[model samples]
Target: MRHRRGLVRLWDYAKPSWRRLTLALLCMGVEAVCVPLMIWTAKELLPPILQSGQSQALRRLDLVALAVLALGLLKGLASYGHYYLGNYVGQRVIQGLRGDLFWHLLRLSPRFFEETRSGKLISHLTNDVAVLQQVLSENIAQVLVTPLMALGTVVLMFLLSWRLTLLVLLGAPLLAWVLQQMGRKMRRVTERMQQRLADLTSLFQEVVLGIRIVQCFNAEERERQRFGAENERTFAAIMKGHQLQALMTPTIEWIGLTGMLLLLWFGGREVILAQRMGAEDLIALLGSVQVLITQMRKFGRLHLILQQGRAAGQRILEVLDLPPEIPQKPNAIALPDIQGHIQFDHVSFQYSSGEMVLHDISFEVRPGEVVAIAGPSGAGKTTLANLIPRLYDVTSGSVRVEGYDVRDWDLASLRSHIGIVPQEVLLFTGTVRENIAYGQPEASDEEVEWAARMAYAHEFIVRLPQGYQTWVGERGAKLSRGQCQRIAIARALLRNPRILILDEATSALDSESETLVQKALERLMEGRTTLIIAHRLSSIRHAHRILILDQGRIVEEGSHEELLGRGGLYSKLYELQSLQARGEGLE
Candidate 1:
């Protein structure tokens, strides 16, 4: 039943290309008709050449040969059209499906990505889709054409000699039962194989993204062993699928051949011994039987392809079926221009697993206020900042922006006015200029340069080989950490967002790099409602107010000087950091 649904979904994907599919089916029909005609002409040509009169036999042979040649030509032309159009339709369907999958993935909430492996998603996009493409490109044509060819041949055989045709068809039920059982097993095996492949891909991606950590710890051999184990599992699953396919093909062929042997024995006896059937008729019956057997074998192979495709299609559909965790409502309105007044009113939040991350978090940041959120690690500082942009809707209470609940605003419009610069800045594989203008693609060259200048990135960018056009390697590997951060800031600056969330943006840099980035960040925060999630106490000293959190609730809210005077959790944390900075031990 699941496989049936998958096939229906696949057909829906194919609906847009009905014209090409219709033309391909017509070509297949023409080709199917020509096969029987060619076989009949051969049978007719045989009897004429065997006649005693040479001139009459030669004349008949010429006409039959011409008829056979014309049929072959027409069949070849139709075959070409069938193959070309079928593949064209297949490519179109896969392209649309792949594109839709990607678009859907992009619209999914960040939590979805946090829970799902990048490798598994990448496998769905590339490997699984490629498997489905094989069904569309090649197997689909065989699926349609082979059955038609087989049916036409069966009809011709029955017309010539029903008894022989009936004898050959006695194996049909057995062959079908074998196909059904093997195909079920093949689907199971193929699904497992795809899962193993996804695991292998996930492991490889995890290792590559963390190669530095692996090399630093000298765990290359350990990683290799882990990868080898996964590869072996994938190999085993693939070989199991291959074994089923190998066993099925010959099992089906043997059944078909057994039926053919029975037909030959019975029909040959009737022709030679009883003289109940003519030689020409027996010959044509044999020809038709060969075509039928070939079609049956093709059907067996097509079944395997269909099983594999169904497995792949199921995987792809699983992703498409997921509703976006943060879906926008039909009545959601565009976020109007605001002065960046963000308020969290009795807000509490939790993940999908029901582990509460924030509790009764009430805060109000007036327009252009720089509110620093200081906390120890895992204190929900970042989570609190995330609520402002509606990355995750609150579990119970409301988060409002400019007097409107964020849930009432369009997601895109809400996020467009916000900018984030995380501690781990990620730059795409593109030019430095492109990275800066990523948020605002239509930014003029001068605007990009101006943002770069504001972020203090213009000097280093201009020093690169191609200036702004210099290609930053993956994740900005070619640039320094400080350079990447500044570029990220420049990206935010270019968008000129009304609100900014700096989640430890300067936490990962050395003193020299941090100094430069901090200066750039100060320029970025001017006249914007900013939420700075920072662990370093020194960075928030100049903020208008600091909200210190512990265990998912605000423990202290005051200016840095006021918090220092209070001697609460904030003071203790500040004292610890101060002692560490001064190279002193805490007693």
Candidate 2:
């Protein structure tokens, strides 16, 4: 029952083409009937052509040739029907499964991507899905057809001579044992190979992404050596599977040979000594045995192929079966455009490991309020910003917008109304206009340029080779860091989200770039309910109110002057920065 579940789950992916599958099976059934007929034709014609000298022998031989030819034609047509239709179903299924896997991956929590490698996920979608396509299209046909061939051949053997059939049947249990053991070995090796392949993929992605680092460090040789190691592991795994598959064929063959020897010895005595059957009957029975062996060979080969696919299927299924970390409730309603009133009431959050990052934090930002959150490194500043968008749900307490818990809001609607420009800028490979209007792809060209102008990006953009139409390379590589940041801001501006988050946006910029970006940020913050996670204390001194977080708690909260006057952690940090700026800093 459990095994059926696994197979049924895979079949469910293909169920969309149930009609095609049914038609394919009907075609396979027609093809299967041809196998025993061909054997019977050979049996009927052999004696007349080889031994009998009767005048009608030639006619009988000719008739058998025509019958065989007709059967072959029927088999060919039926084979094509099943093979093509089966493949069609297989293609549709894997395509759907791949789409589903990608869609699910995109919907998973941000933590999933942090913990998982891009290369491994790519492997699952590409290599693993390909394996499933091959197995289902090719190997699955054999799985369905071989058994029918075997059963038909066995029935013919019984009709020809029940005693010899019994001998063959007696060997079935032993052959089954050999096959079962080989299947286990094949599955183990295939699974290990898949794991190694995923590792190799990860190494490839990492090396490509960090090629500049490798070259800058003059570590090309080291990187090559690392790649060689991963390549060798993958090779070792492939060879292991190849060796197992090689052994399986011969192992099954040797068992078949044993069965054949037993049948030949026992069945030969009946024909030669007792005259119980004609030489023609013996030939027919032997032909049936040969057909049975061929079917068994097909079965064994199919088993080996399926084991490899099964390993891949397991990987794909692992991802598909994962429950989304944050699932929308059945009764969840779409959140309307909010007034940007943000509140955190005793909010606390932990990662998947359950190590608390925010604890018992309570705060509120009125609509259009400019509140800055300042803290030392690792103070959960960004995490607090993240909770506002439901990137990670609060571990305890509630984060609310407009007096309603974020969980109550529709995820898409809520995120759509909130704009986030993280410290790290992300841009796709597209024109400036496209990137700027990504949040709302339907925005007009005038609107895009307006947003760019608001972000202070239009001034520099018009200087580019193609102005707003210039193609930015992958992740906006063709643009400067400051340019990318401005583009991201323009995207957020086009979104026109009620709530905005700026996470150390200018920290990575030069003085010239920072001045431009800071001014742009000030413009962006004019009327929005903003949460500023500040890295440079100087940047947020003019913020209406500041909240200082430390070790997951709100250590201080007040206007910049008020906090500085209190002479606490904020005051000390401010003083240190002030000294550092004036060249009177402590070493």
Candidate 3:
């Protein structure tokens, strides 16, 4: 039942190209008829050669040769049309399907990305889809042509000798039963092989992304062993598939050959002793049966290709079937420019695993206020900031912006007015100007340079080989940490967001870079409602107020001086950091 549904979905993708497929089928029909006609002509030529005088026989031979040449030319033309049209339709369908898959993936929520492996998704887009393309372009022609060819040959055989045709028909059910059982096993084996390939892809991606860590720990050999083990498993699954395929072809051939030998014996005796049919008639009958057997063997091979395609199609559909986690309301309104007031009212949040990360969090930041949130690691500081942008919906209560719940606002409009600068900045492989202008693609070159100047990145950017056009390597590998952070700031500044989030933006930098980045960040926070999630106590000293959290709830809320005087968790944390800065050992 599942396979049936998959085939129906595949047909829907192919429906737009039905006109080309119909033409290909017509060519296949012409090709099928030509095979039987050629055999009948050969049978008729034999009697004249055996019974006529040399001159008459030579004349008959010349006419038959001309007839065979014309049929061959027609067959060749039809074959070309069938192949070219079939592949063209296949490429068009795959192009449409691949495009839709990518577009759907972009709309999925962050939670889906967190739970799914990036490598497996990549495999679906590339490897699995390629398998379906092979079936559509190559196997589809044989799938349609073989059955037509077989039917035409069978009709010609019955015309020559019905007795021999009936004997051949008796084995049809058994051959079909064998094919059915072998095909079921092949489908199961191919499905397992595809999964193994996906696992191999995921492991390879993991190693490449973490090559730095692997080299630091001297674990190259260990990673190699891991990859080798996965490769071995994939090999095993592939070998099992090959074994079934190998066993099936010969099994089909033996059944077909056995039926042919039986027919030859009966037909030979009738011509030699009973004189019921001539030798030329027997020869023609055998020739038609040979064509039928060849078509059946081709059908057996097509079955395997179809099963592999079904397995691949199933994987691609699985991704498309996932419902979007965060669906927007039908009447959601676009958020307009306003005072940046954000309020979290009795908010509690949890993940898909049911572990609550925030509990009864109630806070309100008035327009243009700078509120810093300080907490130990895993204290839900980042989680609280993520809620403002609607990256994750609140499980219980509501988060409102300027007197409107975020859920009531259009998703794109809501996010456009917000900017986040994370600790580890990610820059795409592009020029400095392009990265800065990412948020506003239509921004003028002058505007990009202006944003860069405001972020204090213009001076260093102009010194590079290509100036603003210098290519940053993957993830900004070519640039220093401070340079990447400054570029990120410029990107946010280009958007001119009303609200900003700084999640330990300068946490990983040296003192000099931190100072430069801090200055850029100060300029970014002016007149914007800002949430600062930080662990270094010194950074938040100038903030208007600080909110400290522990175990998913607010433990302290006060100004920097007030929190120091309280001698509570905040005081203890501050003292510990102060001691660490002085190069003192913790007991």
Q: Candidate 1, overall lDDT?
A: 0.88
Candidate 3 — which residues are off by over 4 angstroms?
Answer: 1-8, 52-54, 184-201, 215-256, 473-477, 584-587
Q: How many residue pairs clash in each candidate?
A: 0, 0, 0
Reference-based lDDT, residue 106, model 1: 89
lDDT for each residue of candidate 3 in 141-181, tens digit (9 for 90 to 100): 88999999999999998888888788778777777777778
Please tell me which predicted candidate would have the highest lDDT against the true structure.
1
- Which model, 1 or 2, shows the larger TM-score? 1
TM accuracy, model 3 = 0.92
What lDDT tens digits, residue by residue, belong to model 2 across residues 1-587?
Answer: 33344577877878988998999999899888898888888788877878667878889889989999999999999999999998888888788788889999989898888778776677778888998889988678879999998988888888888988888888887787777787777777877887887777777778888889988999989888988998998999999989877887787778778777877788889999987887788888888888887787678778878877887888888888877888786666566677899999999899887789999999999999999999898999999999988999998999998788889888898898899999998788888888898889999999999999988999999999889888886744388889889999998888888999999998788768888888889989888999998878989998999999999999999999999999999999999888876784333
Q: After superposition, how far is residue 45 of candidate 1 from its true place, in Å?
A: 2.0
Candidate with better TM-score, 2 vs 3 = 3
Better of 1 and 3 by lDDT: 1
Off by over 4 Å in 1: 1-12, 179-201, 212-258, 475-477, 584-587
Error of 1 at 136 (Å): 1.6
The per-residue C-alpha lDDT of model 3 at residue 192 equals 93
lDDT of each: 0.88, 0.86, 0.88
